[model samples]
Target: MNGAGSAKRPATGEAAASGRAVAATRTGPGGRPGSGKSSEAAEGHGSGPGKSRRFQAVTRDTARPEGGGRAAPGDAPAPARQWPLLAVLGATGLGLLLVAFDAFRVGTLLIGLAMIGGAALRWALPSVGMLAVRSRFTDMFTYGGLGVSIVLLALMAQPKAWLKIPFLDDILHFTVR
Candidate 1:
């Protein structure tokens, strides 16, 4: 019986290799092939259940722009020119400044003009870069509405009776009260 048991038992090196083979073939808790937790650890999945896969490092090219080279990974995109938007903004700012100096008529006119121009730009241009604060339709409606309101307010601002809309006073009184 001792001789038979000895014959059946593998040598140390062979037994170690056979043990590794059996471990490799064993399925994990999920019964999926190669899903064993031990294999996951061997494949660089950490020993802890919460451990996530490690990220691989990426190499970037640092070639020149003039030589048809790609931009570096961290490089920021070039700013787009928005002359029309700048013009409108400048006009509106100037209008406010004028109002501060008590040039009410001129200031209101300038502001109204700016709104009208903004509406025109939205209608004509497919893309307004940074100037596009809202959808095209909304922008147009807001600009037009503000422009018309400013013009109407400016016209009625004078003390002259002819400039006043008949129903406006009643509406204003009703809303204000």
Candidate 2:
């Protein structure tokens, strides 16, 4: 008979229906599938709330950026620990307040300076607490770009332009007219 019907047969279940191989021998209370996760773990997709942490090592929590620790050490005071972030925040706040008080150009300039300062701090210091909002390269790029943009806009404010770029006028004229 060539042992045609003597071949081993796999048990049929939900795992089989979904094309997932399951360990039919592993059982739990009432002979149910244990934890219903053994199969998932075996599949290397361990994103469930179980012991298997395949690619979710930091699940249920967020991670700080590479250099997003305290500016100072553990023993230092709270303010000192996050001095860089505080300084940037303070400067930005002051700039906003000044703008509210009818000091547009100076306020914008201060805001731009604060952004540049934040970038510099993030670069020069080992840790900058909240100032390190992203990776070192991303943080630096964002801060520097925003600072330069703000400063340029402030310098080129209406009535008088502190910075003169001949090509900019040509582009403006082409676009406006």
Candidate 3:
């Protein structure tokens, strides 16, 4: 006989079915074909303790302005509200006012001491003083003093105004320049 049946056979539906069977068996613990995932992992896709472990997530606020860039890691922390500092300053100011009403020179001395003590305390323990007197207060005090000094100098340069209230002009005209 000629070698009619000796050539390699063409792949038919039977070959396809057999190929699928081989692929099924080659899969991992799950019944799917050639998947590397485990049976437990496949079964735990939607509802299981392993859900969080299966995926990573990232989130950002939707309301950010259009031109805003990514936030820097070194951005400053939010400023804390400092009612305590305001309360302390307000109380001290009221006390000074009352004292001045009763005794002018003594009140002025006490006010000076209080201001110096406040500055010293802030210099000593900045972290604690940050809680007591906010940085804004210190800034306000510094600029306010400079502004008052400038105004007093402007007034003192005018001898006519100084003549109206000699003691008042002397007290107010305490600026170096």
Candidate 4:
């Protein structure tokens, strides 16, 4: 041999055996002869020349405000509370009972107690969040509907000499709905 043909390259000698060694470590024994490689092969997800390989390098942006950490303050949302509704319901329940039963001082006192009890119940019980977490929309509707009804009753009752209901009808109706 002379000129360009003077030299010959040596073979790597490993080929299939070398590839087998690599696959043996990465994959299990089923990757051999009769395993389920057929299905994987069909989908081009098996260890084959035609199969596509994927590599994903997980990265974090440390420059972020919280250094890309878990559960930064802004990640979680604030708990829900219908503040306006709560206040309105509590005040109206107490006011209505007080005025309606005022003729009998004992009755008025008892009604005041009941109103306080109702307020306690409303406060002690979970907000809509707990019901939503439990996927109990029915309970939410039930409690909400009862509160709406109470507000309605208070609105419809005769206006008390001490406290006049806020709106004549329009505003109250709109709000109740």
The most accurate candidate by TM-score is: 2
Displacement of residue 139 (Cα, Å) in model 1 is 0.9
Q: Write the per-residue lDDT of candidate 1 for residues 105-137, one digit (tens) a residue.
A: 778889998998988877777656555667677
Q: Give the alpha carbon lDDT tens digit for every residue of 1-177 in model 2.
A: 122211222232544576644444344432334333343343544454333343432345678898998888899989999999899989999999999999999999999999999889989988899888899999999999999999999999876878888899999999998
Candidate 2, pairs of clashing residues: none
How much does candidate 3 score in TM-score?
Answer: 0.26
**TM-scores for every predicted model:** 0.50, 0.66, 0.26, 0.21
User: In candidate 1, how many clashes are counted?
Assistant: 0
Candidate 3, residues 41-137, lDDT tens digits: the string is: 4444424422324332233444422212222122433332333344336645864796668744444444554454444434443333233323635
Per-residue lDDT tens digits for candidate 4, residues 45-134, read 635442324331233442422111222133444422434234445555565666676633333434444444444444454432222222
List the lowest-lDDT window of 10 residues for candidate 1. 65-74
Candidate 3 lDDT trough over 10 residues, lowest sum: 1-10
Instruction: Give the residue spans of candidate 3 off by over 4 A.
Output: 1-91, 94-97, 129-177
| Descending-TM-score candidate ranking | 2, 1, 3, 4
* Model 4: pairs clashing at backbone N, Cα or C within 3 Å: none
lDDT of each: 0.61, 0.75, 0.40, 0.39
Candidates ranked by lDDT: 2, 1, 3, 4
